[model samples]
Target: MIEIDALTKVYGQAQAPAVDEVSLRVPAGSVFGFLGPNGAGKTTTIKMLAGLLTPTSGEVRLGGFDVARQRPAAMAQFGAVLEGSRNVYWSLSAWQNLMYFGRLKGLRKARVAERARDLLTGLGLWDRRDDKVGGFSRGMQQKVAIAAALIADPPIVLLDEPTLGLDVEATRTVKNWITEQSRELGTTVLLTTHQLDVAQELCDRVAVMRRGRLVADLPTRELLAGFRERDRYEIRVEGTVPPGFEAVTREGVTTISVRVSDPGEVYEVVARLRAHGAVLESLTQVQPDLEDVFLALVNEPSHAA
Candidate 1:
């Protein structure tokens, strides 16, 4: 459980805040995506939540403990893997890294050992547990860092770009692990990433930010459905496309996509194509995805201060 209230962060003498009155409530055991393009203050917000940075105004609470006032108790509620930073000791073995972090969390040696075995095995690093993390591949190093983060068995996790540079297989492995943690272990996840498809697939809810302000926040399916309600269609024809229409040709067929304000306009498009002696192949409704929604939101004129 995470709660943010009117969180604001202004740097130095900058006229505008990096994060402005951003508020959110992330439910327990849910995967929530915090999305935005570069310089949208996503990392700034996450840092404040992780206590790595203090907010200029407003508050953050973790599991009902105010992050600023109850730093130790609030920190006990979550583990974090920050972006563009090494979360684990490079010279330490994977097992050693976990053991060290677990002990730091006040876990007993025996308990830490047990958790290390399970986490390393689950992450496919058991065989290399004794190898120095500096010698491991980037993906393996990332896995070690994640294991260390989870070594404490905290109820919540803050992951920023957890899959940034991994290969397809490594990315899938991490995604599956995140899913399992939320579904089976009841772990709350606050994820921030540039990968829209990954967020669309894994996030239960999503919030988009622009110019340090919250633009859209909703359940992923509901957001997609809202865009799907628009009247858009894709038509494939076997002959020449008439004027006033843009077409893409593949093989011998031309595809034209159009959006109409009224459903009756679709029939008019069909009639026009027929008038040009074009043989209709197939017609289907166009579906909008997360990328489309993201671009539309981020490109809009900013009204925030």
Candidate 2:
């Protein structure tokens, strides 16, 4: 649904580009995550693809329409909530905001009312649909903004920090809604957020950026699995342990840590410990998670921005 090739953005006469020769592809009906720290060019890349900013070089295509060359066609292919509640009007009610944006997106007038009704009801804002947006809470306004973005029922959704500051319930609501978009509705999603857990949950594939460069891109599972320290293990034992797996005694219990080169070595180590009179209490393999993977990748000296 989305394709970017050699995309770059540079300030006038700057030594380094804000987005440097970045390229990526997002398959139809898939959720793609964009992750990076401050000044890593995530926003710049999104803006370029959304046609909010002109790229210095290269191309951005959405749903097969060249974003720069075919502006209207590209515009019609996606809906966006890049700035959260700011996308909606303060004076407009939820229903009114949807109608206005529906018109702006060139959606048919008849479809606008139908889509607005469905979106408002789906987002739990039907009861408050008539109330002015300025009177709503941030979370409510955000829901309304998201509703407006989907009012046209575009094929692709570009969301930046879709669930940034909402409370637990509200965040869950948005997360489920994004999931529903790809599953039931077959809509493609391009998501960017600082929340690693959210990305881990919703993204099918993710790309990491550093200093405007695309550093990593892979399926969510593969990316996390790649960061796992497979051979690391923690063992609780009594008596004695093998030479390399030296036991440390604390609180009348002996604990040892070992990092083997291969998985089969774990069994060999266990056999050696048993032969050496070690009495094992527990053996636990260290598990890796998204937070650990994200921190390790982002903090890696070469990937740091």
Question: Where does the lowest 10-residue lDDT sum fall in candidate 1?
Answer: 296-305
Off by over 4 Å in 1: 302-305
- Model 1 Cα shift for residue 55 (angstroms): 1.0
- Top-scoring candidate (TM-score): 1
Candidate 2 clashes: the total is 0
Candidate 1 per-residue C-alpha lDDT over 1-305 given as tens digits, one digit per residue, 9 for 90 to 100: 99999999999999999999999999999999999999999989999999989999999999999999999999889898888999999988999999999999989999999999999999999999999999999899888888988998999899889999999999999999999999999999999999999999999999999989998889999878876846889999998989889789999999999889998999999999999999999998887889988887799774222
In model 2, which runs have C-alpha deviations exceeding 4 angstroms? 235-257, 262-282, 301-305
Cα-based lDDT for every prediction: 0.92, 0.89
Expressed as tens digits, the lDDT of each residue in 1-305 for candidate 2 is 89999999998999999999999999999999998888889999999999989999999999999998999998889899985338899898998899999999887888999999999999999999999999998888889988988988899999899898889999999999999999899999999999989999999998988889987888899888887788899888888666765568887788888899998989888888889988889988887776787677777866522
**What number of clashing residue pairs does each candidate have, in the order they appear?**
0, 0
